[model samples]
Target: MEVVRIGIIGLGNMGSAHAKYLIENKVKGAVLAAVCDARTERLEWAAREFGNGVARFAGIEEMYASGTIDGVIICTPHYGHPAEAVAAFKHGLHVLTEKPAGVYTKQVREMNEAAAAAGKVFGIMYNQRTQPLYKKLRDLIRQGELGEIRRINWIITLWYRSQSYYDSGGWRATWAGEGGGVLINQSPHQLDLWQWVTGMMPKRLRAFCAFGKHRDIEVENEVTAYAEYENGATGVFITSACETPGTNRLEVVGDLGRMVIENDKLTFYRLRQSETEFNRTYKGGFGEPEVWKIDIPVEGQRGQHHLITQDWVNGILHGTPLIAPGEEGLKGLTLSNAMLLSAWTDEWAELPLDEDRFYGLLRQKIEASGAAKTTEEKTLDTTGSY
Candidate 1:
């Protein structure tokens, strides 16, 4: 019954995808009022595709002054997230920002502070968590069905990108533009899922990354990280964009059983711990460990981005809880930044990540790398393992 007007900032790949979702779904309680992008082509494309009546702006000032929208979807590149979000908040508009809210923790903190000062609903587009498989995992962990988690291993190498993919955009591989390659762009979803399901923070992390594997890039394309949790649980994070054939397998080993999600399928091996308790009394039939194979029926909406947009709209209009708040966005960015810092410094980095230290390191890398901060208006390759 209520209409939530949305203004989309940045018409890049994900921005375009969100725009399409908004148009196609005719999502309840939400309407795309305006679109903003400095690129004339993108503004024209949105006008042509959506309609000429749709207000198009080449600058944030124009969009904010247009008085045609209620909220903003920040779908810009990495570095622009914080500033765009702050501007949106300043305009008295709610915000739903694209993931990895910021490439560095300091920027995320700044964005959070700005949002807090504005008192608007600021959400993050962590659409992967809306998947049935991960939601089920989070529920199981919360229910204590997984008992005490001892270890976790997430091998998220399915995000394989070629040199041609990186070449499609000038900001693709630079520190000043995209910050870091795989960790910043590809692995944020997985990192968020990891921390979400585990409900614990890593005390320390060490990583070894491949910075020279790709043909034309200064940032890393491959990473292998070791994380030690505060609860003494250990986790392994492995990712790469250069592997020829890659796979994504996440296994969480707990005291009661082990939950494994691979290739969109979830399977849980239920360990019969009660039998061991009985064996303690009888002291017999303890020769072998007992377990039962159970395949979890994964229930999830097929279209993630669309569902995320719908939820954000509902949250703004009807007070629905956000699937991922902007604050949680910092954890993934922190982990990604820490991983690179560990690899670059050849030492383990700690969590509740050192904001000043990470930002200092990131600033140094951006200064040392001779690259542009933002990409010019052009067609971007959107077929990035979506």
Candidate 2:
């Protein structure tokens, strides 16, 4: 096939945004064949906006059976992501899901397994991975330019949302609806980038989350999470959707030097010698390794959401590799889950999270909040890996 037919489920903010570009011919080899939503008004809106150019469905089952789309983009709420993707895959459709893959790993793992079984192209909307700045950061770390990483700290509270934003939708900030607040929504990109650049998940984590701290919502609105890596490296992730003029700073320290990314520019403090080597060989007690401040040139513009859609389409049609493969979504999602689990249990959550326990706790939260589960089953009975 020369082109891929893509259907978008969920006519919310991000979903509508994707529909616009795909219909506008922004993606070279992909077209928005159809759109789905649970709300009738959204379907009517789509009809009014796109006319006969795009099909509309009020649910996924009909859209899946309609045979109009080769793939589906799951942009519904967090819980709907995995279930809808799994269904799509079972119907022999490729899947590109929005981030935080699912409310929990157990469900996402199931979705991953379904995609694997179907042998279909699986992609996630981790559009941040397309940023050259982050791409360069990953290269430097992977190439050992930064040596063995020692620490990672990101103050990514730039996605500030007001109470009105949360109040706009019933599912906006509810525990039963959107899952978690900033961690599940606004901060998923940063979380994905945090682990993507470092190429490792935290060995264990302890987190403090402030529920309804800023917004009048039940889920966490502010979070401070600390993590320890298996290689003795440590990381701190701080995020919130309640701060104005917030900061987006990422600092990574390694044996060779320090790198900072803020204001879309990357800066590196290159050390003459490895910090460990200097510490080992220094004859002068008070002397330190000489540092050179360099502004690392980050090239290329962000391809953003449409680029990811095009890439996924290319993967389906031309055997191209996915920039944000759906499976890799588990790493950042694990971080988000562990942080929430830590806060909920008031303890350090370990890597390879106890999926059953986390699911049980999450179910408890939904019960306490009186929110119903959106997945097919109430039990955490699925498993897979990155």
Return the top candidate by TM-score.
2
Candidate 2 lDDT, 195-295, residue by residue in tens: 98988888899999999995678899899999999999999999988888999999999999999999989999999899999998889879989999999
Clashing pairs in 1: none
- Backbone clash count for every predicted candidate, in the order shown: 0, 0
What TM-score do all the candidates reach, one by one?
0.92, 0.94
RMSD of 1: 3.6
- Model 2: clashing residue pairs? none
CA displacement after TM-score superposition, residue 115 of candidate 2 (Å)? 0.7
Give the Å shift of residue 7 in candidate 2.
1.0
How much lDDT does candidate 1 score? Answer: 0.81
